[model samples]
Target: MVSPMLSMNQATIKHADLRQTLDTLTQTGYHSVGLWREPVEAIGVPEAVRMVSDSGLCVSSMCRGGFFTMPEGPERRAAIDDNRRLIEETSAFGCTVLVLVVGGLPQGSKDLAEARSRVAEALAELEADALAAGVTLAIEPLHPMYCTDRACVSTLDEALDIAAPFNPKAVGVVVDTFHVFWDPNVLRSIARAGREGRIAAYQVCDYRTPLEADPLLSRHYPGEGVIDFKALTQAVAATGWHGDIECEIFNRAVWDTPFDEVSRHVADAFDKYVAPYWPAE
Candidate 1:
């Protein structure tokens, strides 16, 4: 049997709309899903909520709401406001975690430190709203390769540091293997995230060396790449957090496959690479 803890992140089947995403997951034995903003918005939140509610799949989190790398200006202000709306949508789904892919450096700007500082500033601006909504803004640090264009926060430790000043319930970190598995300090950071009450989400995927041209799409099924899922899963379990484990693959080729086929593969991969290390419920 597939472990009930498994959750299919909607990104794993990017071509599917809200209904297809939900139907495919439930039909494939998944008990939950990690949501993304675009798909939820494509069908509108009200309709999306109805479909999700009827699907019987738990909502693990909302995929993203951060791109505050732009310096303070009208653009940055708008980004923060949009995040508030995203937080409300997350709450509407009865989910509390909102994963943040904090943006990398701004156009024509090269100061990495300044960009990171702005992320902290943005969090401060949004924390009150997050706390009020009972949602946690889960900062997701992408791998260093993405530092130039995707996420500036490139390590678990950095994510935690950005989350440090805010209340854990309002601001926390997302431990995603595609992004964090490469960190030598990752295990310690994961333990610290748990200790600090900052582990809002745990996403799994593998990373292989010969990355795709579009490196963001390089995520692979667990055990297919070099990641050590057993060690990562064991560390996360030891922290006493039993949240849903999301299999969030982003490969374009995976997206082209039939949803059911992709899902079966994800399930099998998780069973081989992850489930055994997960403690019994």
Candidate 2:
């Protein structure tokens, strides 16, 4: 059974030092954290690993990998090699999954379908490396608004379709409420993921305000938003998913605040807005 835990994704506390964030999170009773490569590399991977270990914090997942849609050439090959390094780092930190954000359209290219295919090819190459490392590679389907620049895998179904070739190993989908709550087929997708053993992670957050055409700006705390979180949780629970339910909010307003306060707010919001739905059954 996967114990319910929290990870301090870089989204919440942007300006604070990574070590300080980990320390504070540990002090606050969060047993796990998400390590961002940018900050981790800055601090040195070995030292970063040691710091997390010394603090007794488990890393739930590494920040990112798999942006193959850019220059499908030498640049893309370099990304694959870099992802191998990320897998090694995740292993060192005792993380369960290496999160992947499949890239979007290339510069001046409106060919989204081609970008999606590029991601599929890249994942096929990375799948073996990830499985060999005993680490799952979780493809997070970003909100549709980010389709142009973030991730072409913009839905759970799409991700599962791409992950079809890597079953029973570690290629899977990440269900983030903010990205998927509005999806017409979310319930079926979650159940399908469960059936296929492809739920690498499930993230819970809400979209409070009515969405603008821009999907990036549409995110809210679990209950404060319009997401039918009850239905979402019911679907996830139905699949017997005991994995970490991450709270990944990328709100600009939240990131600009104090770290301590954001943690408190996020934790409180989890309890008040998100946790009630995931009752232990």
Top candidate (lDDT): 1
Candidate 1 lDDT by residue in tens digits, 33-85: 99999999998999999999999888999988999889888998899999999
- Model 2 residue-pair collision total: 2
Model 2 alpha-carbon miss at residue 139, Å: 1.0
The local distance difference test score of model 2 is: 0.78
For every candidate, C-alpha RMSD to the true structure in Å: 0.9, 2.6
Displacement of residue 155 (Cα, Å) in model 2 is 1.0
Model 1, CA-based lDDT: 0.91
TM-score of each: 0.98, 0.92
lDDT of each: 0.91, 0.78
Looking at candidate 1, what is the lDDT of residue 38? 95
- In candidate 2, which residue ranges exceed 4 Å CA deviation? 1-4, 210-218
Q: Can you write out model 2's per-residue Cα lDDT over 63-101, one digit (the tens) per residue?
A: 888787876678888988898898898888878788888
